[model samples]
Target: MWTKRYSEILLMTFMSITCTRAESEFELRDVTLHIIPANTVERNSELNLTCEVNVVSRGGNTPDLKISIFKNYNNHNPVYINNTRSNKVTYTIAKAQASHSGIYQCDVSAGNQHLYSSEENINVTGLQTPELRVDKLKVTEGEKVRVTCSAREESGVLEYTFKNGLKVIYKESSSSGVVQRFHSLTSTETAKFSCSYSIHVGNGVLHSSVSNEVHVVVEELKFTAKITILPSTEVIEGDSVYITCDVEGINKNSSVLSLSKGSRLLPRNYSTVVLANDSGVYECRAKVNSAERNAYKNLTVKELFSTPVLTITPAEVFEKESFNVTCRSSKIASERIGHDDVKYFIYRSNKMISSDNGIYKTMAKNETNGNYTCTAQVNNTIKWSQWITFTAKVLVSKPTITVLNEVILNKPFRIECRSDRGSLPISYTLKQNHTTLSHVQVSNPSQKAVFTTSIQSIQQISEFKCEAQNNGVNSAQTSDTLRAQVTVPVGKPNLITVPVEQDITENQQLQFLCGIPEGASSPITFKWYKEKNLSPVYVTTVNFTNAEYTILSVEGSHSGSFYCAALNKAGKEEVSNHVNVSVRMARWKKGLITGVCLMLVTGIVFAFVIRYRAMRVKVASSNGAGIWSVRPPVLDSSEVVDVDEPEEPNVEYTEVLHPQNSDPARVPLRKGTDTVYSEVQSTSPEFHDEF
Candidate 1:
């Protein structure tokens, strides 16, 4: 027995030494452990742990061993066991809790030898819970906003959750490596948001922080400014006008203000003041930080000015008369400065004749007659307010009259008057021995006044004077007076004849008479003349109203010439032309009975004588009487024969002297012829006896 027991002991001792050498060879190989499902834990879920081993084969690979997982490195508390004989192992904790979250180990054991073992720590995260945050607490609607969500206490990657009142509106993953941005968020979108995250941790799910709450105030963007114009009065050119722009209620603090004419901007200035050159509308604008506003205004400028105008009242005046004149002006403002102390000057002929405080005055005695003007002067220059013109006149003086000639009956004469030189109206008056004769008014301004009158038989005696008056003033009486003379005269009577003849016979007696009219006053002289020479034919110087003288008989001497003459107190006058008268003896005045008886007796006696003388002359002529003997013998004293002579001559003798013949023998015989013879008486007586 002893011998056999010793032999077994020796064999056991040899095997134990061989086993130790094999374990040392296996220890020289490298092994790695990896856990599945990461090292993080999540709440209300299972914890799955996977163990993996990476082995490097060194050339003695018998078979890959199986792996086992232990919780907290304890072999008795096995979380997983794998019998498949591989290098990887997996362990799962179902219904896991916060208490189950801890470090775990992976073990790979074959037979009774531990091949590989590794420990991994795991953290339990409540799930993939995410938190959200907003950078700004309050934001206007339609503004760009940022929403962020992150895992709690772990930052693997970031994501953003955008929601509107607990509703997921948008989501972006942090895998893009950029911050998520949301622009122009609405008011509803600024409410509560749901967010979650996933990160690389021990747990498969991610934990989120709290949900961020933000109040959103929707604000309407307002960009506005005001425009103000300075010195709001009547403005003129070349004057400065100031304009300003005031910005208000803008969205941004930093902005620019723009001023323009139409659309062009002017140089930079907040308040603009410029010398106005044109008149129109001006525009101003304000540009805020992304906002704009504008304003406009109109400006005007004037060119002309207003002043005072002058006028004159009652533009004319009379000479030497006291008349009121007035100067007037209009459109003068009642609030005019220093106008109450204005002075006016009255000017005539371009000379300042008078001056007054309000309107100028004229002298009561007019010195000159012409146009008068007025002007108002301020300082040295004349104001347009006062200027006017008017006309004036003067009066004339009275007149007096004088007479230069005397007036005669049935004659013509004239009178004259004189006056002083002036412009007033004047008239003249004529008087006869202080009694008014005629009154005449002279309208023209001439030198003298004259009147002409005639003297007739009706007015035998008259005296005259003249006076003149003008403007109620009379001139002195004239020194000269007119005189007159009166007289009467008669006319001579004319002579008449029966037969107008040149001469008269000697025996003819004509009648001559000197006479005048019954009422004629005359010392008349009646005388007859021959031709124009005076002959002593007849003369009668008699002063009688009706005187008559006669020349009873006229001879040849009265045929020479004849005329008459008459004289009066006026003058002496003669007969008109001339008259001639003739006278002769009457032959028919003898008695007719005596003339017849004497004619018969003378015839008878002449017959007897002629017979006696013829008987004797016949005896003588029978005896042949010669012519000398027939001349009867001259009778002697004894031989004278007696002839009976009657008491009156038998015939009247008429002078029968013929101028051409003077011989008496050539006288023709008066009666019968002379003859004596007796023979035949005897025979006649015897015959008577026988019967």
Candidate 2:
């Protein structure tokens, strides 16, 4: 097992290296296959096939080119040893037979590419006939003779078939260890035996002509041997019986007599318990010199009950089908026991599936597939039937297909195909428009196969489907057809106006339509932009056929180059051709502007006229001050108008002063402390003095 795993690892590594270089970088050509000696060889001879290749090495020791040899059209795989790193490799077939003939070819692996070679035919003709022989030309009765059948010149694996008068009695492969066989004769008669051999060659078998026949004769010796049973030849099992042997027609002192029961030598008079197995031919042998004589008699011991057999109704049972199994004994010795005394039971593997009633019937299921055995019991004599295996074949169920995402044009998308129920080794095929895209065989029923494909055109997306088949490819169950339309890439968008005009006035409703060449299966997202701004002013997702961006009132802000972009499941953006839009004012707006200008001029003139009148109403004053008042303004005092100025203080000469009116403390000390000061009178009588 370890060796097998190591070989696998090596193979994987070699393949990895072989694929390291790009296919175009590989330089390989001129692979030729040659046959040695001649195109044809006789049987039991040697034939050689050589494959030669030419490869351009990549600036190193000769690139270790790998070569694979093949026979017929199975060129994808090598005949043996898979790949070998030899420029020229020879395949030798020793002891060649007709089975080894075929058209041969070779494949060369260099760098990363593979090259095919021309074909050559190798033919192996003729077969060696076998020889048959016997050790004795004549043998006494009840004696076994050694028979040898061989093909001395034939060396390879051959099948030896020994025949008795055109009827094959024994056949075995040459690889089997048995070389010589024994032929036993019970009655005095003449018999002929012959042999032939067959060899397996390229997809078929080749048989040689029958060999020459050898004849042998059996006769009774001069002194005969005899055997007798005391009770009877036929008896019930477990009954004791006596057997005796006697010799005649020779001196008793000279001839030796003995009894044998199937290779076991017994006394001249033998006694033992008779059993069902002991019911066979017993022999008595007498030997003198270089000759032996034998006599045989058949004994019959009845079995208490025969082995039970388990039978099925339908040999080939499939899942969910009804089937039955039962246990029954074909023979029950009525003399020993009645049929009702026996009981029957059935089992699956080691677990009993049926009770004493014997019959086990049910609808076959996947779990019911196993080995079944049956038994019959008569008290303690239980007999079992040989085991028989039953396996159910489950039909493939209808499959369902699902896509991983949406199918995009020119992009690989994954599609999963699955069958809910089926037997192992179910084959799945993916098809587009009835053309097979890919196929795979799944060993696990629960496993699903994934295939990658892309839609290059609209026609390629029509009707993709999956086929599930367990019986054969020709007979397959189909899944519900998946009709997938490709998510077409957003084509160059075409932006247009409602009236298809170049200019429009403000306050006028405008409609801008953003559309693609064709609709996509998935919703298309549209973006509308004006001028050279990187951001779109209006964005929406809808079918491109009916997508539009509308403006309730076309304004100066909307008066720029208008364009739109469209995006779909294709994951790409496409922009439309720019359409310039100009917005201008209406003629009615000019009159309204003129009227507002007249009102502004009248108001300014009126304000200026009022200011001039006010300036005229003002009066001048000497001090630079005055405006007109409600009453007349008073005159400035230049001379004494009302009363004469008070005369200068006459008392200035001797004005008396009140000393009690003056205080020395400036803060006027109070709080129950009286303090006073005298003051001198001033001559300014115009100013009254108060303390």
TM-score of each candidate structure, all chains considered together: 0.29, 0.34
Candidate 2 residue lDDT tens string, 37-151: 7889887777777888776655533566777778877866667433555678888877776656777888777656778888888778897777788898888765778878777
* Candidate 1 lDDT over residue span 1-691, tens digit each: 9989999999899999988776654321434555445566466456666665554433555344666676665778776777753555556666444435556776665554565555678666553344555666565544555666554443335555666666667766674423444545544333554455444434444435545554554454455766766675345433456767667775334657766666556543433333233456767777653345678877674421122333343343445455554443332333432455455666656776666553545543545444556655433434333334444533444444444454433445567765655443556778776877776677776545677765555343446666665545433334345443332223455554533344544445355444556544345555555567745456666667434335555554555546555555434454534555444434453345568777887787778866755544322223221222122456786334445534332221112222234334332333234222211112234333442
lDDT of 1 at 632: 42
Among all windows of 10 consecutive residues in model 1, the one with the lowest summed lDDT is 649-658
* lDDT (CA) per prediction: 0.52, 0.75
Off by over 4 Å in 1: 1-332, 337-339, 358-367, 378-420, 445-453, 456-462, 473-623, 626-691
